[model samples]
Target: MADDLSPEFCAVLRDAFERAGYDADGVLRLLGDSAHAALGRGEPEPARRAARDSGALGSLIRLFLLGDTLPEREVRAILPWPESVSTGVVRVDGDDVRAGLDVRPYGDDQGSWWVFADLDSDLLGGQVPADHVLGVGHASLSLARATIRRPVGSVLDLGTGCGVQALHASRHAQRITATDLSPRALSLARATFSINGLDVETRQGTWFEPMAGRRFDQVVCNPPFVVGPSRVDYTYRDSGLAGDDASALVVAALPEYLARGGVGQLLASWLHLPGRDWDERVTAWLPGGVDAWFVQRDVADPDLYVGTWLRDAGIDPRSPEGSARASAWLDWFAENKVAGVGFGFVTIRRTDSEPRIVCEDLRHAFDDPLGPEAAGWLDRIDWLRAHSSPDALLRAHLRVADSVVLEEVSASGDEGWEAVVRRLHRTDGPGWQHEIDELVRALLAGCSGALPLGDLLELLAAAHGVATDALVVAALPLVDELVRHGMLVPA
Candidate 1:
């Protein structure tokens, strides 16, 4: 009944569901029965729902999840969600519904790889089961988190499974177009939008097939980057192209659809050839005229890689039925110029200046960092694009903004908080962070602009005297913080 979805209303629903004592499955059943008519097909009731009190909240949650836009006040007053599930960008498209605590059982996260399903979507042209439409993995979220920024005009969420990134992006962009290869997934995305009340443009397509020649101010994806080509491109696994190059192919060709200053972020994996640098392999995926932040998080031994990939498709890693298939995946990697497999995140922005390519491995804990990190990435891309490398002087003086500070509040109020900023490429041209004391001193010392990072470390060692290696290793994160905070710029 409301015009825009509000966080408070969502919270209220979330809180009520917590007290209802219903498991995820139970609540879903109640929702099913209440919202059945809106489901279109024969939507199964998630529960028996022996109730005489199903009212506005129930109706709203169903309507919202099915894809309606409600007013802001309604959403906020419905309270119960924590920060992680709290609102980001998705605004109401139709009526707003509230799914309280019960929403959790319905969603999960995969570190590098796993299965994802949103019952809201329609898979296989609307007939496939919700479980059949797997959502994207953390690898993709990593990249999307790294590159996106605020104030983007319109965005295109490609391959939007349950509208994950699309839902997130709706927070900032005025308009969003979400596309998926499976109508099931699109259906679920629509449902998610409806439930959360986010207005988005949904389409069906393979890659950019549905929106050919269309452009957006920003684009994000979590494609089916899994290696080992599959005959059945179900909700989960697909290397789409050969030798897992499908992900690379998408990357290699992203520029065609990218706006002049638009940014594209994604998670991808690539093969490492016998004599080739993994860095070079991924760099090749980047199209011309784009600045890139590419991170290769982990690599696997061939057999290990094969087994791991197989397990992702809901196949048993140690089962006999999976052995031959897993072996084939390894063989494919070996036969196709692949020495080892590399998995990671990449953020690219179209720029006229010389492209910046940064490759690193960060397996550190990010701690609910999907929002601002991505925005920072876009801002940095703009900085790099505007002022090419061999940056004679990083002449920008800066103030560390409040949002730039991440905190760990202590109940005693006597606790300490760490302030971090990244000065990328400071270590051999990659910026460093002011993460710890040694790196902090090193970075703060560099404010004078005479000593190189290495020299600064040496000076610190001579003065306060810490081990050189210890200092060097720890300096990287600290320097990363500096660069991230705009406190330090490449001179």
Candidate 2:
């Protein structure tokens, strides 16, 4: 484990990093796109080759990122060697210096920062310890991108491994609290905060325990959501709870820690049972008085899921020990009758009115951050709720969202290039697509924000020789759905 450093030392360290240009852009520029991407994929030889002639930045990347040992004199030229050694940032063996922990540059649209975590198992040349503090990885980045980034009074980073989410939250949140089950994780989290000059309260406890009576305006979590047997192999990935219970517990307990109108976002995995609807299984986990959106980004069969996690733990599925572990894991899945594992994002907001819940599979690629879309979705829900009455909905004027594009598909048939399907596609955010019929297409075309929805519906009804009431009845629900997804916006 790494030792803590004083705030002054941390400030000095931050300055050294800044002066050496050891941040994301600096590293990327040093390594170039190909080598940097290769490093991101955990293949460091390309980065090593790229950094050979680079200066202090190269030494920093080699020592910290590639786990290379440098001459003490060389490392001393770049860092405050005495303080870095005393604080466990690096260790000295003879005349060589090596990083004691993993420190890497992480940034977003806001600013640059460094994350502290345990060294990779590959670098350690062994399995990670039980209390391993994970660095910024895919799931953590996904949650950070998906989080609604509006300014808030307070934010809680539950299961804050290495405080990555808290680091992002610090940009917008006035007060931030980060919690984890492992003391080592909390220690590294505190260091991460200190080194970044961020003021965050760090607590060591299980999910929601440290947050007993406190509530936050926003909570972001990337918990131990890997579904598996109730055995603890690693603290960062295993909750020691049977099958997705850890995820369930966190989701169920969120309402208590969330202030009224507060929002919570997390990356989670849920079981796909033989007969149960996957969406329904997740929907049942929602508590009352909260609006939730569950988007399943990927699904893996039992074997694939088990193999992925096993490899993540540094186990070869073909090895004897790995085979035995795989068999036991497979048996557990069979016993539970789990068909597949669904992994996705879950965003829930505490509400005072009738709760609106949406559960669906969104496996498409997105070009925009989900944070803005998430905030907009909640606001659209509120708009729909306020206009629940048919008359109220008809009175409002709406226009097609700027990001929406109408796509028409055609097939070569007997009639030659006949239109088969027409859909409304959102160009950004989640990239939601909705198929539409003639009536719906015409309604959207006429939605120029020049007239109330009711008047537009009546006009369409008159043009189509349909009853005005019937057209209004069919159009209201469709308009509501469109608005809920940001395909349409209030004029």
Q: Which has the greatest TM-score? A: 2
* Candidate 1 RMSD to the correct structure: 12.9
- Candidate 1: worst-modelled 10 consecutive residues by lDDT: 107-116
Residue by residue across 1-491, what tens digits does model 1's lDDT show?
A: 12122434444444454554333344445655454444334343432132223544443344233333345455444444343134322333344433321132233232111112433232211323323555444554565555455778889888887666776676679999999887656755665565555678888877888888887788888877766655444554463466667777778877777888787877787777788787887887776888777767677677887666555555665777677777776667666756777787777778887776777665544444444555565576556445433221133332233233322222333455443433322232112233334346434645555555566666676676678667666654454446554555554
Global lDDT scores for all candidate models: 0.56, 0.89
Report the Cα lDDT for candidate 1: 0.56
64-104 in candidate 2: lDDT tens per residue?
Answer: 99999999999999998698998888989999999988988
Which residue pairs come into collision in candidate 2? none
